[model samples]
Target: MTVKVTARGAERWKQGHPWIYRSDVAEEPDKTPGIVQAFDRKGKFLGQALYSPKSEIRLRLLSRGNERIDDFWWSDRILVAARRRNGITATAWRVVHAEGDALPSLVIDKYGPFVVAQLLSAGLESVRRDVLEAIKYALEPEGILLRNDSAVRRHEGLASEVVLAHGQVPQVVEIVEDGVKYLAAPWSGQKTGAFLDQRENRNLIGHQTKTGGRALDLFTYHGSFALHLARNAKEVLAVDQSAEALARGAENAKLNGISNIKWMEANAFDLLRELERRREQFDTIVLDPPAFAKTKANLERAVAGYKEINLRAMKILAPGGMLFTSSCSYHVNRDVFNAMLADAARDSGRRIQFVAATGASSDHPELLNVPETGYLKGMLLRAIG
Candidate 1:
């Protein structure tokens, strides 16, 4: 099958953008979702792409050439993505970061001996068997679970489901990351069992935290950051709205044999305000909230929410204290997130210095050309006054 796109779509491909919207398609193939050759309206071959008849993103460029995209190609791509994480010292990490690894609409995460994958688009779903075999051939993991529950799949006319594709997978899997132990629920946990993108950032906060001082981890789901913070801080408070998640975090703390962390179940926004009103201060603070802006329309409201918590955190920060804040919203670009932080700092009535800007771990590669491949933006700050 072949698809012919308009000049604008052809130019988008020429400019290195991977997606060609449905509106830019001049000629559509009368076929099911699968791999298809893409050409310009002028009959010039542009690339080979994964075609989804129902998606607004009609085509996702797989290769710029007419190279054979078969089982071997799939395995090779998976192997290449795996090789990129050769030196990464973690049992759980993102093996394929969708477009970040040049495998659009597909995500694969490894948790110890098991692997969880999400074929987010109908195009990818059409080649599900090939992709699963490629994962087996490349990684040879003990098991592979298809985590196709993402809301993005609906846009492609695919149903949400979680199925065990191969081998055996446990309900809970133990994995180690940067010398910290934690549990991953691949079948039910958030974003492929846990927020693997923040692996390096958690390590950063762990290393930067001062000893014998109070530390606060707001919205600390499963206590990934809190576990790291507890290693250095005399006392740590890990707050989250989900008591079930806190219980899992407590298990992680027990696994590490660390008892310095206190898990609190509360709304992070409300807690931040309460802490500020009580004049409570902390030497170390981490604000890793869930995406407040799921869509572009929610950007303004997300900025307000982000600023409110950041401003409260800044006000309650002790002199010379460290604060680590981040946003994982794809709509929240780095510039906008930084601008919001600046606004928060100005209103915080505290002198703050930008220590460092942070991002997702190395395994989650971000392409310079594709800004959407990088959604996690963060800042490490220190209070000076």
Candidate 2:
């Protein structure tokens, strides 16, 4: 079972990194795809690893040493990780039983009383029964859905499939955030149909709000940011190109019986430019956009896109206002991302001080050496006059 780690691969594994590149594989599995046994050159058992001849990452280490790979062990690890994220459940949460969470190739989102997962790798697909049983046993939620529709599936030579893993999920699940309510779909919406990672970000916005303030939430999918501010700010405006999202945002307002939130279904780029042209300004401006670049290949153009929007966004910020901005793209590292924000500040002729910035919840542990694993980044800035 020992998959000989070619010369340099042993060094990386010894250094605490978990991946072994394709070039480092000195042997090929007799099987084309799925989980396989791994070992050192001396035939010493290393662990089970997900193997893909197609991926640059030839091996994804699932376990090391004597650990056995089975449903019980899998479920135990998943439940322990989810229980540790007790705070995340307050706002739809990432049950991060995914590769990034050390459950490589599987990502789960807990929306309200429901849970959804995506089997992104072929190896995980082969072990689908093990993961499903683990999820059901670990978190007895109202429902569970398997949404394996991500593009990553094709890369692993697996077809996308969406099915009910357990229970029934309603179209809209109500979530309370900082004492405000929002409804998100667990089965049919965006990634897990809600942005749980931004729950803390929303709370930060509410805490930083000024009395009688006006706010703008760009790329405001479902109004989590705007609604949180609505409770404290004088007015809130949520903007997104997706009418469906805007409609849902409005529904969230209605669900909470709050009427001060305005929904804007406009091109985000044009909308920001229009705000700048009209000299319209808000006391608090939130710039939470989707991942402009998923891969490093698109990083340069993505930076330009971020710089343009942020610079314009900075232009309309009132003195003493706060700007909450974020990029969930793994390619945009914190240092590189922060520099772009600084560029926008300079271009817009605004002096801003960063109040706070952070990434995913502790449940979403970042393997120290794997930079690509920790993707979500956010910052709070005080816009100076």
User: Which candidate leads in TM-score?
Assistant: 1
Best by lDDT: 1
- Over the stretch 67-157, how does candidate 1's per-residue lDDT look in tens digits? 9988789999999999989998889999999888889999999998899999998888999999999999999999999999999999999
Residue pairs in steric clash, candidate 1?
Answer: none
- Cα error, residue 99 of model 1, in Å, equals 0.7
Ten-residue stretch with the least lDDT total in model 2 = 1-10
Worst 10-residue stretch by lDDT in candidate 1? 365-374
lDDT of each: 0.94, 0.80
Q: How many clashes does the backbone of model 1 have? A: 0
Q: Candidate 2 on 161-254: residue-level lDDT in tens?
A: 7788788978778777668888877667777777777777888888888789898889988888888888878898889999988888898889
Q: How many backbone overlaps does candidate 2 show?
A: 2
TM-score, cand. 1 vs. native: 0.99
**Candidate 2, TM-score vs. the true structure?**
0.94
